[model samples]
Target: MAGPGGRMMMGQSGERSMDFKGSGRRLLRQLLPEKAALWVMVAAGVGSVALSVAGPWILGKATDLVFAGVVGREMPDGLSREEAVEGLRERGDGGLADMLSAVDFTPGRGIDFTTVGGVLLVALAVFAAAGLLMLVSTRASTRVINRTMYRMREEVQAKLARLPLSYFDQARRGEVLSRATNDIDNISQTMQQSMGQLINSLLTIVGVLAMMFWISPLLALVALVTVPLSVAVAARVGKLSQPQFVRQWQSTGRLNAHIEEMYSGHTLVKVFGRQGQAAQEFAEQNEALYEAGFRAQFGSGVMQPLMYFVSNLNYVLVAVVGGLRVASGTLTIGEVQAFIQYSRQFSMPLTQVASMANLVQSGVASAERIFDLLDAEEQAPDPVRGARPGQARGAVALERVSFRYDPLKPLIEDLSLAVEPGQKVAIVGPTGAGKTTLVNLLMRFYEVTGGRITLDGVDAAAMSRDDLRAGIGMVLQDTWLFGGTIAENIAYGASREVTREEIEAAARAAHADRFVRTLPDGYDTVVDDEGAAVSAGEKQLITIARAFLSDPAILVLDEATSSVDTRTEVLIQKAMARLAHGRTSFVIAHRLSTIRDADVILVMENGALVEQGTHEELLPAGGAYARLYAAQFAQAVAEVD
Candidate 1:
């Protein structure tokens, strides 16, 4: 049966043994959060089992009393004909009285209707009481386990928030999702079904064994032999099945990951005509899952029948020996009957324990995986309290900045630059030249390895992350809009409630108001997930409007106008010119013409600044910036021709 802590007793060796204790301890600790309710449930379960166990023994006693009454003999336990008749009369049971009066009071001849009827009624009442207690216990357990799981789910969500972006970069989205959903669900089911089954089984075994020994120690001793044999069988099978359960869950995660990738990239797969290839990969994963699952289930499946076989042998032995004892005049038939029933009862829990072994093993494996996630190293803790500056003039400087995704290979080194307030600085470079890394450092998305970046002469790290980000606004090329009304999308970057007028003004500032008003709902038009209903250019405009609504003192525009047509680009350029008039703006672009009027054009190559000057000055210098401008200009001419 399910053991304490809701684990099956796998009398095994190696990791299985340790898993039994370790996983059991952790699961118990999780339950302790709802311990008060759990304890009450346990009490009810105990009472229910106690009442149920009393049934067989009471029936056995009543059997002996009735036999003696029919024989017109007094019971050895002090029950007599006079007492039975008197008790029947006291209860005013006329039907029983009439039946008893018809019987001749001859030894071992007729039934004692009153005593037998009364005893059967008592047994029914006892059984009904037990059933009620069981119902209450199960209901309480449901509430307790569900609430505990709810708290665990909340903690997992909060834990995900505290983890670093780097963690997500290294982890698979589907695998993480599987842990949160499937793995946790396994634990929930195990607690609900296996826990109560285990508790009831254990109580039944204990009560039945006690009764067995009280009646005849010889019969109990024979039944005890099967216990060790059953244990050995369980241990051997459990050890074999444990690793398969691990493999089963691991394969399940891989299958989920593959499905997620296929679903997310279904269009790409179809365009490439890779449906056959995709099916092949899925079949491989599915086969692996099937193999592991079959092994795990088949291994544990053997234990129940094996234990039952041993139990059947024990039952036959008890019956044969007990009959012999009755024939020798040392045991009553009623006592032998009770002992045989107890022998059967003793084996049932063992059978239950064997049957639940697979569930318990799978649960432990899932729990271990979940705990691994919970114990993963989180991001370095942010300061509990830090500087929250009121205002910023937007002067930014980087000194001796160096960074690398990996320590062995550096991506950026000694990247130093400075920008005064209200200056438009454009950073231009080819792909993989670290143009975006600078913005990442400025935003503290990734920490610099070597040097400090400053905002208005103060080390940016000295300020809280919230305070640092509050003073700057960013508009990225990959626009993101949630499922909401257009007005909500525009007001997303705002810190407080935004009125309709303000949202419209922000849209106008981004040159998006005209198109927005043309929609059926105007600013209230609903945007689907990923803004799929809108064109790429319109999505970019929505993001620009969101940035406009924030109105930070500093702005970072990374290819903000790349998706729009020439007309929309020109409008956006004019709008951005107004937005950046007095703010320190950092512009990153590939089209050199977009930043021709920037106060300073910084050209980067291979993670270091190679050229920095006004647009006119850099063109005359014939340096890296001049070459980039000429290449782009020639490409544009070639395209037009």
Candidate 2:
């Protein structure tokens, strides 16, 4: 159900079944780094559950002491425990006499408060020690959970860095971000809330079961009869609810995508008067999320009450069977009481685990998503010792290059060009032409499927991506400015530290200094990620200034002047002309008027070079370049009218 590029379409979760047990094992394996701490947690949990389980058995001894004292006081004076049992048997009360035979008491003595008090004190100490051990277990579990989460987050970040640019180009922004943030957070919370408790619950079940069988094997069997029923119920509900949780998370991602797209382009939505349409789409996604979330929660929610009911049935069976054993003298009153407590202890853990099914299911579902991202294909590793351009003279050439985004559809094929240092080349084409793709190939954002590109006769592919990109400066049409001052934004392009003078000089070269000084804070003015403090043209100018600051051997301006007014565009062109004076420059532009003075122009159409010459020469030939010029000129005339 996954569409192209690993983006899951609607209903994918239903079609693709989740491997609950496999994912559970993998999730636990993520904790291997904290193995020592987990062992400590296990040790503490065992000690805690052991002492806690001892509480009831020890208290049962106290009960027996008190019962014996009370029974002794009821007997006639001067009669020992044996005398009372013999008297009962002679009175034809053989069952009662047999029960009395198990009790130890002196005929004249009342309740032995001293002995009862001693047992009660021991019980209190055992409980206190158990509490302390549980606290230690909880603390250790906290360390393991937090450290594991921290490592997982770092791994996810590193995985993203190693992924190819093409993966990001095809994947939805929401799916990626949701995995990084929402899902990881969910896993963290689930572990924090459930890890210690789950460990204790499983240990408690084992300890309690052991004690139950130790007291009475017959009663232990009765208590365990309902366990399989509980398991069946939990497994069935979990199977039904697991897929819903996956769908719920997927819906969350889709809804996030819609909201982000709408918010980022709110102006466009308003300009086109499609606010209602956007709202409608938002409602649909929200409703789908709500439906998925409700179903997941509701299905898992049924487990707790169902489990509780089954446990109650087990309790009833144990009590009835235990009472009969007591009446038949098979078990004393105190022993029967202890066996009943053990039955509850055993059932309680099963119920607790069943009740936590939702959290476990949700957490594992999120882990699966994170693992998928981590296991995604990464770009090829860089060579151990990649080549670098020799002093970056910037002599660039493409020899018999072929490339495509999709293997089935070629975008650029058998394209070749050469540019000497200090020459500017202009690429002109309509939308979907290979103009930008050509620049991408040269930048090595995408590897060429065939042939080679070389920088100063050194193959680009042989060079490390970082080393290859270091000597190139690019100013994209869609500018990006992080949250910082204008000075910092411009300095981002510099490979090394720059002084205030150098920063100002770069801004001046891009014709952005005069307008910047007009602002309240000048170069220190704070701008957000949206660059809202600056106008559209100002943002573009800042990006161009950033490129100028780099002072690279090669400059790429991809529609860099598209956002500016005519006067600003003319000034930028002049500044770029000066910058291109001694560098290899590739300029991609749609406004043909901007590149008229270029040393050479290449016309591209349908992934192929149809014409190549100087502007004057190509216009005379009346090829693809000439036809594009005529159409643009006509549009300009129509706009003027």
Candidate 3:
């Protein structure tokens, strides 16, 4: 049930805690290839922040100019600013005199509209330049993010192609697919949302801090006292939420795997009356995902408000300090106003950076999953210049070969077989007898642990996998069809361009032409991966037709006729008899009657070659093959009765 198996998967996944710092660093390294673009973005950000920082200071001057003109009005007509301040001190209004001492005013003057307008124009220009630079920074960040994700996707795809088949055996298909699709997309979104803003925010903090210190060092220090507390909040919350993010993505993968498995086998579930069981499993996985997602979100969500609280505290501190300086006449009203703005500017970016913890952590979590895939051990590479026999003679011989999926439990050991050119070898065995595994070894889907296999006296391992597989054609019991026309599906097997006539010829040879002609579109009928337009037998026939179209020197048929009716099966057998006459064919079958005319029949039991001879020779020997034939014959007779 999903309740226990899913928990076990979560347990296995949770065993490795998230390396938050390591993953973040690796994500940054992903951008190294786009370093030039990042530098452009950073330079633009710095310039924008610099001008932005100066705007407040410049605007404060306009405030001073306006205030000075107002104060100058209604003053005595002939007194200088110093004379008026002295006059106010003598009149027992020392507070006004102190403020006047700091204010620049001309006696007998009202607000000067010309000077005020000029300062306002300068302020507008400064801010507009800052905005234009920000636009440039944003554009550059977009280029960097897009290019980086483009390359990352390409790398992930290529990595999947290089991974060994054994890796997929151990990994869940939907989980791997999610990592390649969903996780990569998540990473792309994270960069898109965070990269440019983070750059601007960080540069804003630096530029704002400089202006704050230049205005008043004491107030700047007062504003900075709460920064350590903000940092502590961010780090602690990030640590708590980082593992939750990792678990969330893992849960997503497990849930996806379950959905894919159930949906793919829904027909079987219905036949077995397991709908309740399936729904319960789905509910359990969905619940696990909800919990993980909630915790990760709530944990990271705590940081933004905390940072806001810290920013407010810093704001209050700067206002109090700046107000005191203004009252004492050490700083002007405009300077204190500008200093208050600078303090806010400094704290806002910190809050933004703190708030980004969620996106950053989630993105890094996905990056780690993708990086794990990229870091997995790849299958051994082919030789640069591999051995190539000019033409394959269809001679394959295994010498003392051995293999084990698990190191401790051997499946096949010291098994050897040789097939001469143009020989039809029928391999018959029980379910766990390694009959299909023999074909896999010959095709080099897996590497043997102990011995070597040779084709035409040249080592198979020395030959490129592409070259080796090109000479052999395989039709599995499990059929697959992509989304395309039926004719195109058959043509997939051909290495070069194939005509419509060739596709029809292959279909006829596989006995599929009659049924295919009944369809509305005949060879041109469109079918998806499920091949729902046709019966299971027709799907199998299409795959068999594909193999026929290839016309390789060697053929591997693994229960290839199992899905068809007996009449169709007999027709396929007759066709195979004609086509396999001069080809080296390895046929694995459960029905012994199908291989009665084989040149030789090899019987495997528990990974050992126990009997080998013609059907007539082995049936009378009274060994493993004789017992198997007797059991099947008895079953057939009893069914008839």
Candidate 4:
């Protein structure tokens, strides 16, 4: 999934996307807080492996005890002792005859059942203890992993808040969400299920190697040769497949992003009849995802069979060498049996390690994405000397303020304006003129690159952003109503706690109270994120009510009534007139007639105020404002016809 880095495309073909060494170190650091608990779990796993390793050897000793008892019984029940010795010598088994004289198996009439039973009981206890330890370690690891993931999730959320608004503007919402949810989920799953198994597998391999060496150094050396060979095989395959897994994950993120975009714009797609085009795009992304997934699975899939083959080959070599030693009486049958079990145990963990390679790779890829977000450039820190503008006096002055979203292409340059307290200043210009840019600067959403804007004679930059924004209320054309009841949305920008009576009064002032009462639940109606349940005009009214409730000293209405019908527009204008009665207001409207009553209409062209006067003064100037006004009326007349 995408993160703060936005889109994550695949690396060069066949090249892995992440640096394993760097990501591994970072991942380790993330787990450092839980280190003590992890160590305890590891200790339990080690204990389990140690006990399991001893079981085979003890059973071999028990086998030897039974063999010895059988030999003792056979020697007495057969012909004479001399006959047994001659038979051994004749068979070229002189060593067996010499060992028989030293034998003292006559301590019991039958096999030493008590001794064998004791050894068997001890083995059973050890096995049971090992199982118990394994369970404990598994549970411990689970607990630690869950806690660590929770911390990581919290950090991600905190990091998102610290990020600059520019980051959100550039990053896709779906991609950002993908990182916060899907990518984090992937990391959690891998850490919980794979990490514990990985640790146990390594410990098991070590324990098995120790037992293999103790059984027979010669056979142990033979088994050791396959270790490097198996690892080499796994490494080679994993390297080729690692890129595929990276690509697979990236493609999945892209697919999710595409789906989210298309779904959100589903209405637009239908309006434009672009279903076929959207489906084609979806198919292409899906195919890419499928190919990446298949290749990754196929690459990691080869490791198990290859490791198993290597394991089986090592087992055959050990069996052959062990059989030779046993036949010559240098090693007993029971010892050979124990070595075979050890060899099998040793190879099994390597197979498991190979099996986990894909998960580890995929998890590391997810970690890299998450780390990128945590490492993004944050918003510039607020000045230490900044103070809160508790109550602005509604006076705003812009000096020769120059600003640009991109430095190379200046949008607002050498712009100067003065807004008197309680005056309605209407800003109008062509599409690319800096109408909204001025609002952004005034609110300090984006700081000016040169000069300064002051609110009540205090530099806006010198005031805390929250305080500056608190003094200004905005009703935008694109009304934003979060998921809440009508009353909650209306009280959105209010600085202080608003009672139900205050909310109702604000709604009534905005002319929204009548329509709100028509709903079954009145002010308690639930609105979705997009406010889909309400009409566009109703949403605008709610936003206007929000502005009225805020009752800021400075108000901004950016096409506030653009979405409402003619009848509703008249009501909203009346509400706005009352709301702006005692405030310094900026109205940015394309409908020239709506701003005809503005105290001073600032006719802007290309970010420069070309003319400044009341509506009557600019009507006869035959300037840009006159032309724009004429065109607007003509368009409206044509629409009516």
Per-residue alpha-carbon lDDT of candidate 4 for residues 115-170, written as tens digits (9 for 90 to 100): 99999999999999999999999988998889889999999999997776667766
TM-score of each: 0.86, 0.96, 0.96, 0.90
CA deviation > 4 Å runs, candidate 2: 1-14
Overall lDDT per candidate, in order of appearance: 0.81, 0.88, 0.87, 0.84
lDDT of 1 by residue, 230-346 (tens): 889999999999899888887787788789889878988999999999999999989988999999999989988898898898998999998777655466666777788888888
For model 2, residues 431-517, the per-residue Cα lDDT tens digits are 988898899889887789999999999999899988889899997788899999999999999999999999999999888999899
Worst 10 residues of 3 by lDDT: 1-10
User: So what's the TM-score on candidate 4?
Assistant: 0.90
Quote the lDDT for 600 in model 2: 77
TM-score of 1: 0.86
State the lDDT of candidate 3 residue by residue for 1-641, as single tens digits. Answer: 11212322211366578777888898889899988888989998899999999999988888888889889997988999999999998999898888778888999999999989998999999899999999999999999999999999999999988877767777888898889888999999999998888888988988898898898998888999999999999999988888899989998998898899999999999999999999999999999899999999999999989999999999888888888887778888889889988888988989999898899889999998988788777789999999987778888898999987667788888888888999889998888998988888889988998899998888999999989999899877888999999999999999989999999999988888998999999999999999989877788778888988888889888766766788767776766665676889999978898788888788988777888999989998999889988999999999999
- Candidate 4 stretches with Cα past 4 Å from truth are 1-16, 77-91, 94-109, 494-498
Give the clashing pairs for model 4: none
Better of 3 and 4 by TM-score: 3
* Candidate 1 clashing pairs, residues 3+ apart or interchain: 1-353, 71-108
**Residue 519 of candidate 4: its Cα lDDT?**
95
Residue 349 CA displacement from its true place in model 1, Å: 2.2
Q: Give the TM-score of candidate 3.
A: 0.96
Worst 10 residues of 1 by lDDT: 8-17
Error of 3 at 474 (Å): 0.7
Better of 1 and 3 by lDDT: 3
